[model samples]
Each structure stands twice: as structure tokens, then as C-alpha cells.
Target: MGKSGSAGPLMTLDINRFNGVPLHLQISEALRKAVSNGQLQGGERLPSTRSLAGDWSVSRNTVLQVFETLISEGYLEARVGDGTYVKRQVLGDFTATSATDERPLETKASYPFRGLSQRGKALIAHRLGGLTERPTLFMPDVPDLQAFPIRSWLRLMNEVSGRLKGDILVNVSNAGYEPLRDAIAQHLRTARGMMVESRQVIITTGSQQSLDLLARLLVDRGDPVWLEEPGYVGARAALMANGCSVLPIPTDEEGINIDLGRSKFPTPRMVLVSPSRHYPLGGTLSAERREELLDLSRTTGAWILEDDYDCEFRYRGQPFAALQSVDRDGRVVSIGTFSKTLLPSFRLGFVVVPIDLADDFAKARAVIDRHAPIMEQMVLAEFMHRGLYSAHIRRMRSLYAERQAAMLQLLDETLSYTPPEFECAGGMHFVLPFKEGVDDTAVAHELWKDRIVSRPLSMYFSGRRKCSGLLLGFAAFRAEDILAAGKHLAGLGDLIRRND
Candidate 1:
């Protein structure tokens, strides 16, 4: 049980007798032995309760008690806010018997890490702030909540506040609130055509939290993770941070190509895709490709993460039902977010996992952030029950449909003959693939000067591929604005067509 403080990240424990001796006691003994034996000398910060929860396969409360017991015993120090750090002084001095030898790094605090050390800042830095401060287009993912049904929300919140008994309010389900999950299950079934029970839905703080939870649960270091070539960059960053080797899959007009993904990065354990509508590209996955993916998952025992990102605003005919509806093999984990559907800042989303993995996934979530903000969950549930969510979505659908039409007409009249192959099927954004070799970054840079913000296709690549396209989100923009931006991009589009 000696913890080579800097050795392996986890310490294995006997869990077969879990129901007997409290888990914290076992953990305390294991940690104390590691320190006394000098395997763990000093000054090592223990993994946060969230991190240990995943490793021990136990609750955060269990780990919390373990820390408290060890701290009281002088074996560990609870620094409170900054997390628990191992006190090297616990063992007095291990090198007191040895001749005093000092190294340069030893003398210097904040020494640069030797390449292999875990203390180094990650090699692959995350690129962010794309739309974090109000998307360049000035319309971000969140709706102006002030314009939403705030009065009705406040009334229901007041009602929930009044009804909450002390014990009922204090209690929590490791997965989430049961009534909220049931409400979400019903909402998905009636609105988005997904079939699942409340038991399958695990609520989260937006899709980012869902990605973090999935990485902790499924991915080991360097496990192959396949992502769309021109996809959401933030998702890639999340997977990479968890030590997954991300492989990029090229997209055609009909969404992610299954044959290409399987042939290219064939050994990946998980494939992430936005099948309902291709992200940025904004095309539905052809039926053939959808079946091919499910077939691949069933045959290879791989799990598919279907990000049903923005199916709510179809703006056309009935949007395709989620891919999980037919995934009978328990290989699909469907994630959806209200970030775009209602508001982004609300940061409420859920993952519909197979029933078996639901408990473990919740354990992983509890490890990360104990249940999402309860107040927001309560408000959303009330919104759904009082029929405001449905009405709001219906209103947004009509508004976005008009905006998309106006933008398309503006494009046809001002710039190109047509946009990409997909036509307003569903999504907040659509792609206009530039002629090959047309630097999308340069084009976007030019657009930025005019305050007409457009995302370059190359930015989405996993630092691979010579992709040239522009991703323009229409839902966030008003008709007049998209019209004006189309005019500016047209001035740039002419240069492309002429070069062609």
C-alpha cells in the first residue's frame, strides 16, 4: 500500500468487503502505510475527492471521510480551499541519515519539469474564447433570458421554495432529481422523438460537463478518440485533457463519413458525432452512414457518443430522430443540451446512457461536480411542466426558420449561386465550403474586420487537414444582420470564385 507519491496515479483497494468496514477506514490505513514506508515522502497533494471517487469506485462522501480521519491523525492536512496536500514532515526526514546532497532543481522552487513528470503544463494547450464573450456575431448561444418567461419561472421557483421540507431539500439522488429526469425523458420523447426512461437520463451542466464525465469513465490515457474533422474544438480539448489521442474524421455534405472514420482511425474505442445535424457543416447523416456507425459499434464493441446538439430548431420538415432510438446494443450515449435550445449560460444538458452504465456515469459525475445547480434544474422542470419550454421552442423555431431563409436568399442574390448541399434541415449553423486551398482563416480575419464574425473551417481540424470553409451560425443573428454580413462575405466570396 506504499504510495509512490509520484508513482501511479491511483491506489487500488479491496472493495469486495465494501459493505463491512467503512471505506474511509481502509483508505486511511492504505494512505498512512504509504507515507510511513517513505514510498510517499511529503508535500504531495492528494487527488481531489472527485478524482478519488472515480478511482475508488465510491462516493465523494466516502473519500471526504477518509481525508478527515487521516487529517485528524496528523497523516494528512486539509488545506481547506486549496485541496489536501501530503505533509512531508509526517515522516520527519527520510534523508537525515544520508549525506546532505543538493541539486539545482532542489534548490530552486517552481523548477521546470523534466519532460516525463506529471507536473508539467500539458503539451497541447486549449484554444478557447471563440464565443465565450458573446459570439463575434454578437448573438451568443444563450437567449436573452430577460425576454423569456421570467415571471412564470419565478412563480414556480417560489412554489418549489415554499414546498421544500428541510429533509426533502437536503436529500439528493446520486444521479439527479428524479422528477426532473422524468420530465426530461417525457420532453425528449414528445419533442425530439427519442425513446428512453427517466432512469437512463443523467443531468449535467451542459455538454462540456458530460464530456468531462465520459472521459473520466471510459477513456484511459492515449485511448483513441475519433472526432469530426471540422467539429467543435472545445470537445476535442476536453478529450485530450483526459489523455485521449484524438483522431479527426473528415465530413462530406451528408455529415461524418463512417467508412472514412473506420478506415482511418479504425481502432478507436469511442466515436463522437453530431448525427442529427452535422455541427458547422449542418447536414443530416445519411441513413446509410447512420446504420453503418451502429453496425460498426455492435461489431467492434465500440461506444458511440451521439451529440444530438441542435435538433430542436429543424426549421424545415421533421428533423431526423436521434440515432440512439435504434441503438439496441447498448453502445450509444446520446447527449443533448439546452445551451442552444433555450440558453447557453444556463449550462443544463443531459446524457442518455445505457441503463447499465448510468450508475457508474453518475458516480463519475458526482466525482466531478456534485449534481448541477439545483435551482436551475428546478426552474427548467417548472418551465417544461407549465408548457413554457415547448411554447418558447415553437417560437424560436419560426423565428430561426425565417432568419435562415433570409440569409439563404441574401446569399443567392449577393454572393454564390447556392450554399453547401444541406438545406436548412436543422441547426443553428451551416457551412459554405470554400474552394480548395482558400485560406479560411484569412477569410475569417477579413470578415472580423467588418465585425462580421465567421468561424473558419480549418480551426475545427485537429491541427490536420487543409480544410477551407466558413461556419456561419444563423439562429443567433437577426435577418438584417445576416443580410448585411452576407454582403461583406460576398465581397470576399467574389475573390474566391475569381480564383477558381
Candidate 2:
């Protein structure tokens, strides 16, 4: 006869140290509850430490320690000639009853349904991310896998790993690997003309994570925030999920209309912009507009989030400097991602915050997820430190320039259809606008039937004056491939036009 009562099954205990309580204390508390609740009767012989160890899936020494602790507190007793038993004095506080007299605890129960929180509902309503899962031809924002410098990257990884020590492996900081932050800061100084320091950089998993962190840290529920019309969907979704009242400001050839934004929603708590090069539409925010936005930030005390995604792929004359470079008042948070320049799977990005907010953001990041993988950070740091990162970017830039030209050439040469109009100088994808009345979403779906995947421009807009177009990615495809894709598109154009 084991110590377990016949009327009930053996006691079950789950031990996980990650629950923030010590292992011994958790076990002691569970056993104490069994005694106090009359589940274990007075003078009832308890299971041996070995028996309890087997049942609880814990070490015998751990169970013995728990037993020792409980015995010292008078909840359990030990007899020299026999095994341990429940202390009569402790059990006397409760009525002596068989285990059968007490109802068994149910792990689960049915209850009336309740609604989710408002934020939960907002998140559900505006779903984002997962854009790269089923990548097809012309999928926007995808890097050329064939052109990546895998050999150089692998060599750098080997070099970094060979020199790695215990301290580097275990001493991961919430701010990120210091050397990597330094590398990013140095790169940004020359690349985007931003005066930043390593300490202000907070490494995140991706741009999506950067957005989420900013939403959690700065945005308050129901606070009005300015977002560009036909803007990045991920930004809108993140802000909405945090319960921000999003104000969609319209855009033009020179980027977001600052005067219109001022007229419509003069004061917002936050404003998110892709200033260096806007996504999908591919417009650089004009210098005058940049000054206006900085002035607005200064006057209203509204925070400006500059998403400098894909700023390196500019094929035109010198690309504009980052908007953060002009904000002397530390109100701008500049975000950049290696996901566009490097592989998205790398999952590395950084946010440069004001020096005053650095420590708080670091603490907040630690509470969210400790930090990004240490080894990857080390490898990338070495990659950049050795100048391989800049070299890779230059190579990809040349290759992408060729691909972009090829796509444009094919669109112009294809005789069966009219080429879409474009005004932007650079980005990974080019906007292909359709007639005003045509639904680009339907055209994109029809193109998908021919295995050509392109994002509809209308999908990015959240306002009434939505444009109709397709965002065709050229950076990932070769010249020959782009021409082939154009042929398929031209062939499908007639069918689509006939149906229309």
C-alpha cells in the first residue's frame, strides 16, 4: 500500500523553475495545501521521498528537501523507526475526512463566453505581417537570394564563432551586442547622415518588433496619431492594436502633404513616416516638408517615428538624408532594418531613441524578450566591422539597378498592354497604376491566376481616396526573368481587359 489514499489517485505536482518561484518552495506549498485542505488526513503516513519523487517527476533529493522544510514547519512529521507522516497538530486544524469525501479538482471548466479587450479586437480587425510566407513572382520587398554574399557571410560567421568566449555567449544585453550597435551607429553616420551613438540603439527582431515596441512604450489608448495615406500597413496595424486613434494624412509625389496634415489634424501624439524613401509608392519626403514636420514636432510635442526601410536601394542621384538628422530636439525615433538590405530571415533591426529614453527602452525590451540571439548579433557585428556589409550592399545595389531598368524596359516594350505610370526614383518595388475606375485588387487576383504575385496598391490605403495600382517588385528577379514575367503579364492583360 503506497501512501496515496485508495479513494483518490496519487497526488500530482508540476515543477517548473521558470515560473519565478523556487522549486523547493513550490513543492512545499503544494504538499502543505494537501494537508490544510483535509486532502491528507491526520496521522496519515505520507509517501516516501523516493515515491513522491517518482510521482512528481522530480529528483529524490528535491523531494527530501521539500519534506524536510514542511516537517520543520510542523506540517509534516518524521519518525525514526518508520517513514514520514502528516503532523497531527497541523491536521487537527482541519476535519479528518477521507479523500472520497472531497470533490476532485477539475483542470478545466466551461464558462459563459466574454468578449475580448478593445485592443484585442483592434488587433483582430487590422491583421498585419506574414507578407513573405507564400512568396511568388513580383512579391514586393523580397531580397535576391541568388545575389547574397553567402560565402563572405559564412566566413565571417566562422571567424566570429572561433573567437567567441563564455562571457560573449552568456552576457547578452537587452540593448544588444555593444559592438553591433557601434557598427550600426557608424554606418548610419555615413549612410543616412544621422548623428547617433551606440548607446541609443536598441536592437529588435525586425521592423515589426520596432513598431510594436514604440506602440507599447509611447502610444496611449485613444491618443491621436498621424499616419500617411497609402502608408505601410504594418505601422497602421501596430498603432491601432495599441488603441491609438489613427489619422491618415494624404500623400503626393513629394511624399506626405504636411500642410494638409496640419489643416486636418493639427496636433497628434505621434507621427510615423518613411521619410528617406516611402514604401510601395517610393517617394522621398521633400526637404521643405521635412522642415515642416520637424517644426510641427517641435510645436506640438508629438513624437516622430522615421522608418528608414530600404533607403539604401536608391538608384537615382544622391538619396535624401534621414529626417531624424534634422530633428535637433530628440523627438524623433529613427528605425532601420537589415531585413531589406540583408536577408529577412536575419531578423535584425535597430531603433535610435533620444538619449534620455534609452535606459527606459532597454528595460522595457528586457521585460518583453530578453534580447535577440547573441551569436547572430556577434556575426553581423563582425560582418560590418570588417566592411563586408558595405561591400555586399554596393553589389546588391548594382544588381538591383539592372533589374529595375529591365523591369521598366519590359513594361515599356510589351505591346499588348499599357505600362503603369510611376514618379518615384527608387525602392525595391515600383508602383504600376491602372485606370481610375479599374479595381487593381481584381487585376492583382487575376495576375495571381497566372502565378504572378503582386500586391495591390489599394491594400495599403486606409482612407477614402484610395488609388488603384499594383506594386511590382523588381529587386529579386533577373533581367531575363523580369522580361518573362512581363510577357505573362502582357498575355493576361488582354484576357483581363476582355473580361472588364
Candidate 3:
């Protein structure tokens, strides 16, 4: 066993034949430690695999395997006509410092001194401010996961999996799976009365991604965008993350006040609104306000983003058509997600952009994540095409309607707390407004401490017109569970009194 060339120094490696460890693993670990401890300096040529194998009394394949592992992990590199060398700059200047230095290496000092960009700082500061996925009582935005049609879904998944061919697996359009886009387009046309072609449907990871995409593609940094006050925190966060100057417009019994938005930010580049059913506050945009908002978009060249989320669960007279259905000017970008209807883990949502913007949005989406998983998209397309999606939605809608009524009644009975005015239509959650001087955030925190996950309504607002209240969800829990939680909620009056 000897060195293969005169270019590299001879080295000793400790090997135990009877240590019960695989030689390959021991060799890899030893090399890793050596590199980490600066024993193997960066750019230092290593002995040929043949020579190392001879020196260690191992096969050439073993040395080759070890080298391959380190090379794949970026710890080592092989140069043609030269030899295997420790990778340079893989972990900064670890090679530049001599291994025989008198002082010990300050590992922490090697960290790069960098700061987040302006947009990154903005994103970090704008917290979505909500609870975790814990199945706590009164948690908002969580669907009844147990009630989802898993058996049917699994059957469809299997069928799709079996039928997936080379084209289905390897070939995917950047927008999404074409069949899934067709399914979404058809569903929107039938359910929400939207006029959309499959080409306009750009599938996204979820509603958050949709918002972020819109923020990125439509507006630039410091551009003005109007948001509904006491609205969805997620939309606000996404807009701010893109460095959009978010101007909060107030909402009333009617949806967003178009007049106020115009008065404050006269010409914002875009406006994100939940016109079908205002989130948290739960008010559909009045017909007049819809017209006014559309007119504003047409007049000022502003793009209106209609978040028609949770419109599938309306318990009222009839579900309203999406605002885009009435927009003849092609200014509306309709967004929908299955998170509230199906499970949130599905991570499937779609954005229906104007025909002119569709190409750019798809290109941008391709850059963001290439596209969502094709297998799930195929299964969902099959699920929708077979009419299972509608049936599941109808079942969950009915069930949540019952739970909503039961929760409202139980809250009244248990705590003698009933809002004089509240929207009893669609939406997974409802807001209970407190009078002035009550610390709703403190109340929410206290309830959370007791395992009740209620959100402070004030947390949804960034403007001066903050509403103090709690947003309690009823869609995820049973009537009995809500009542049981209501019993605990009844005793929390002392805490509210203390906060007051």
C-alpha cells in the first residue's frame, strides 16, 4: 500500500475491522470529521481512490464509494486529469486558515454578516397572527377534517395512480394539470357563475400564494393597494410582503366602502377584497357597492382581486355569484381555495386572471415553484369531474350550518352573550364585537391559555378603526363540543371583567 502520486501527502486513518460498523460509513464519518475540523483543508488534493484503498487495506470500490458520497455532499470534488480535492469555498474560508493555528477556530465567527432585504423585513414584520393547527375549541378557518370523504378520495387516488402514464407523470403544464384547470373552470362556471376558460385558471399552492403572486405581478414596491379593514390578515401580510403600501379602507354593513378607499388612496394600483362574503365581519358587498367598485376599477385602471373564499358554505337564501361574473371590463382576478371546503393540507387553490394577464401569471408561477404536485391535481380533477366535490361540499355545508346555529344558541344560553347584529349566512367563523374599553386581544389570549383558540378581531385590522372582538369558529367542532366549550366560556366573564 503506497501513495499513487507525489502531489499529495501521506495520511493515516484509524480503522477498526471488528467494530461492527460498516467500513464505508466509518470512512465517510472520518472524512467528514476531518473536513469539519479543518484537518482536510479546502483545495488540498486527496490521494487517488486506488492508493487510498491500498493504504487502508480496502477494495478500490470502497474508497470510490466514500469519495462519491463526499463529492455528492459538496465536501469533496474531483478534477479531470488532476485528482480528488477538498471542495473550495464550500464552507467559506475553512481551508484558508491553517489547521496548525495556535488559536482555536471560532466557528460562530464564520457566520456571514448579512441582513434581510427591505421586502424581507416587511414580510417578517407582518405576522399572520393566528393559532396553530391544534384542534382547539373555536379555532377559525379549520374545516371538519374527519368529515372529508377520504374513502372516495382514496379510491379516486388509486384509480388515478393506476392510470397515470408517461405523459401524465412527466408532462405537466406550468399553469397546472390541464384536466384540473378544466375541472376548476367548470366548477366555477356552475357554482359561482363565473365566466372563465381553463386557460385563465392558474393553479397555486393556496390562497396565500395566489395573493403573493398577484402582489408580485400586479404591483411594484411602494405602489398603493387598498385592503378591507378588519379583513383577512393573510391578504394584508402578502401585500405588505411585496412592499405594497397597503391602505386600509373601512367596511360597513355593506362590504368595503369604495367611496372611502377612493377618498384616502385615490388611485391605488390594486385592491384586494372579499366581496362574496366579507371575512371576519361577514357582510356581502351590496349590489351598489359592487357596481361602484367595478366602476372604480374601470375608471382608474385598478385591478380588483375578488377573494370568493368560503362562498360554498352559504346558509342563506342563495349563494351570490362572484364579482368577476359581473365584471365585463376584465379587471377582476377571482381567487378560490379548497382549504375551507376540503382539508387545508390539500394546498390547492386557483386564480382566474384576466385573459391578458394569464400568460404572465403562469410564467411567474413557473418561476415560483414550477407547479403544484401533479398526482394530487389529477386526483382532484377526477374528484370534481365525478361530482364528488359538489356532494362533499353540500354535506359539509349542511353540517356546518347546524353547528353554527347550535354554537350561536349555546353561547346565548350559556353566557347570556348575544350580538344584536351578526351575519348568519356563510363563513366558517363569526365575530363577537365588544363595547369600547374591552381588551379583546387580552380576552383572546386568556381564552387561548384555557385551550380555546379564539382570535382577536382587532388583530385583523392595521388601520386606526380597530374593532375589539373575538372571532370564534364553529365549522370544525360538533354541536356538543361547542356547547361544552360554551360552558367554559361562560365562566370567563371574570377574566373579561378583569381585562375591562
Candidate 4:
């Protein structure tokens, strides 16, 4: 038993011997709490280590260790000839109270500062949907993960890792790995028919980051930006987050209505479009409309943002060349991602900017994230160099085509009513239109209960005249899985057509 010092009695600690917690940690926590709660006052001397050890029934080394920890943390200070004392400044403005006083401290209920800024709140409010680590059946825009060539990818990764030296490791480019940029540029020239150089390609994390960067650099706040109505929710979110006034331009079989957009919001700062294949609806922009859109952009001095996403998955005739291929002036900015082609987790994408704006985009990229992961970029470059990426794309095209055919057949045989405007040539998903009175959102929620994932087409529309439908994806699932899910969907045909 240790005697009380001149400072008064040491506070009693309820140390549980039966518990799994170590004795030293419990003792240290007790002392820390005592100091924090004003039980131990500043400049007050503590019991000697030996006396404390005896009183606490712990080893002397444990007590010494605890004292050293507290001293390092500025809770206590050690003197040469004197005992350890609480630091004088540790209890600033706190009244010294007896350990026996067990009254709880009072605190204010509310804070003066607001939680989130208006921009932050708006950014979160525009979220389209939640993402899952493991995608379920019929989830739109998800690639088949199980079919990815992991062995070849691993081999390339190992090769890149082995070749890494001090110079290569330290001297990474701010824009991206040079070889990867070159590979991407070359691929775009041949595949998408875009006349791009490595310098014009600014690599980004994915399409989302590319959109965010372009919005920040190209347009000012409250500027008019036209987007396809019943369009991609992500594009809307990105534009709205940057304080752009998003104008919903309706689309038909020929893509965004250029004449309609001109009549309503003629002087838009930027126009975002998926001309190769319209999202959800899957309509390729007609050649006439494409020319008209470009001419309009030139007249209005507006920038055109072409989202060439999933253009590689076209299962029908030859896919149309990228809109950037026909750009006479330096206006169209093209962006694409590998998430739909390769893996979503890789987050590899690129933006093709005009030659004059390339340096500015690179500088902006440097400020944003420096670059994508260096090793992954190097690996991807090598993968493309060996023609593995092309091969993988070819294999996926065949696989997805088969899956899509199976899904269409299953839907035709299963459903009682005819699917409206269900002619999709090549894309990940197609919209199954419901009657005007039918609630697509309620039907989608009901499908979720049966473990069948589908995006409500109404959620994609920001305008008051929303379309009632469901977007069903066929690319990510196998034929058998599609068949299994289709049976469950068949049972809901009556519910889907009830309003009709």
C-alpha cells in the first residue's frame, strides 16, 4: 500500500482483473482520464513509480513505461531530484476538482458553424445511384469481371515491376506515363478514327474525373450547358456540381434535337453528347444532325463534349467514327474510359483536347492528382503494345453479343405485352418502355426484392416530362443467368402493364 503525497490522495481506479485488457493499458487510461477531467491538477506531483506499482498491484516496469508514455505526451514531466508532476500548461482554464466529484460535464447541444457548404450539399444531392463492389444480374454499364484475362494482366504487371529502377520510379510524368498516352492515342486514331497525338491525350482517373476537370476549366459558373434529356444522370450531376445551368435537350432516333435545343437554350457554353450511341435509348446520331450540331457549336462559339463511352461494344454494323474525326476547328473535346472495356476499379481514362489547350489541361491534371497510378499505366501500355487489349475487346464483343441476343429472345418469349422501341443494335443495355400511367420507379423497387437489378428510366430525366421505363443490361451477365432473371421478370409483366 502506497501513502498519499502532499498533493492529496491519488484517485482510485476500478481496474478489472478478469478482463482481457492488459493492466498497464488500463492504468495508463485511468491516469489520462484523471488529467483530462481535472482530477489531476497542473504542477501536482504524482506518487513515486515504485509506490504506484505497489498500490496498483502491477509490475514496476509497467508503471515506469506508463510514466514515460505520459511524459512524452506532455501529460506529466519528470524532475531530476523531485517526483513526476503534471505539466503546468496541461490544465489551461480547467478548475482543479477532487476525484470524488463524479458530476457529468455539461455540453452545448448545437454548433454555430453550418455542417456543409451549399456546393457540397448540391454535389451530394445529384448522386444518381449507389454502386456495389460485386455487381448483380442486369446491372447497367458493368463489364463481365469473371471473363477478364487475369493471367496475362498479372504477367504484364510483374514485368513492369521487375523493370522499375530508381530513375523511372522517381521521375514519373505529371500528365501520365508517356508510353501509355502514346498507346491510347494510337488506339484512338485506328479504332475511333480520331486524329490525336500523345500530347493531346490527358489521362484521368475515369470519365467522372474527366467531366469534372473539363467543367472546371472550360465553363464558368451559371453558364448554360445543354445535355440530352432522359440522359446520363452522371453528366447532369457533374455539370450541376460545377454550377452550370443544365438545359435538358430531348432526343429521338437521331440523338439530341439540335433545332429544338437552339430554339430554347441557343447560347449554351458547352454541349455534352453521346452521339455514337445515345445512353439508355441506344440511338446513333444521324450524319445530318452531327453536321448541324457542329455548325451550331461553331456559330455559338460553344465547346462540344463527346462522351465516346462503350463505343467498342457495337454488335451490329461498323461503328461510326468519333465526332472529333470531323472537327475542322479545335472545339470538340472527346473523353472515354476503360471502366466499360476493362475493369471499373482500374479507373483509367483519357481526354482528347485541342493542341493549344493540351498544356493547360496537363497543368490542371497535375494540380488535381499528379497522375494515375504509374505502375498500372505502365502495365496497361505493355498490355496494349502486345495487342492483348485489342484481343480482349474482340473476345468481349463476341461474348456480349451472344448474351444480348439471348436476353432479347428471352424477353420476347416471356413478356405478354410488346416492348416499346426495343430495337438496339449495339450497347450494354436497352430501355423497355412502360405505359405513361405505369410507375417505373415502383416496378424497379419491386424487382430489387427479387435480386434483379434495373435502373428506372425516369431517374435519368431531370425535366418534368419524364419517360416511364426500365433500362435492362445484358452484357455483364451470362446467358443462363439472364434466362433465370428473365423468368422472374415475366411474372411482373402484369404489374408493368397494369396502367396500360
Give candidate 3's error at residue 231 in angstroms: 1.5
Decide which is better by lDDT, 2 or 4: 4
Q: Over the stretch 103-195, how does candidate 1's per-residue lDDT look in tens digits?
A: 234533465643443312332455642523445562324343434666777788888877567765777666777778988999988876777
- Candidate 3 segments whose C-alpha is farther than 4 A from its true place: 1-112, 128-131, 420-422, 492-500
| Candidate 4 lDDT score at position 160 | 90
> RMSD of model 4, in Å?
11.1
Q: Write the per-residue lDDT of candidate 2 for residues 1-500, one digit (tens) a residue.
A: 53342222378776786989988889888777778767777688876677777787779899889988888777888888577888776733444455555666633344346567777887767543323344568888889887788998888888888867877777878999999999999999998899899999999998989998998999898999999888988888889998899999998767889899999999999999988777767777888899999999999999999997988888777888888787899999988889888886879898999999999999999999989988799889989988989999999999998988887787667733333233436678877766566777777777777778788788898888887877888888888888877666774343322212
The C-alpha stretches of model 2 lying farther than 4 A from their native spots are 1-116, 128-132, 415-424, 491-500
lDDT by residue (312-428, candidate 3, tens digit) is 888877777899999999999988898889997889999999998889988998899989998899999999999999999999989999998888787678766554343787788
Model 1, residue 229: C-alpha shift (Å):
1.4
Please list the C-alpha lDDT of all candidates, in the order they appear: 0.74, 0.81, 0.84, 0.85
- Candidate 4 has a TM-score of 0.79
lDDT of candidate model 2 versus the reference: 0.81
For model 4, residues 203-315, the per-residue Cα lDDT tens digits are: 89999999999999999999999999878888888888889999999998889999999999889999999999898788889999999999988999999999979899988
- Model 2 is weakest, by summed lDDT over 10 consecutive residues, at 491-500
Q: Which candidate would rank higher by TM-score, 1 or 2?
A: 2
Cα-based lDDT at residue 252, candidate 4: 86
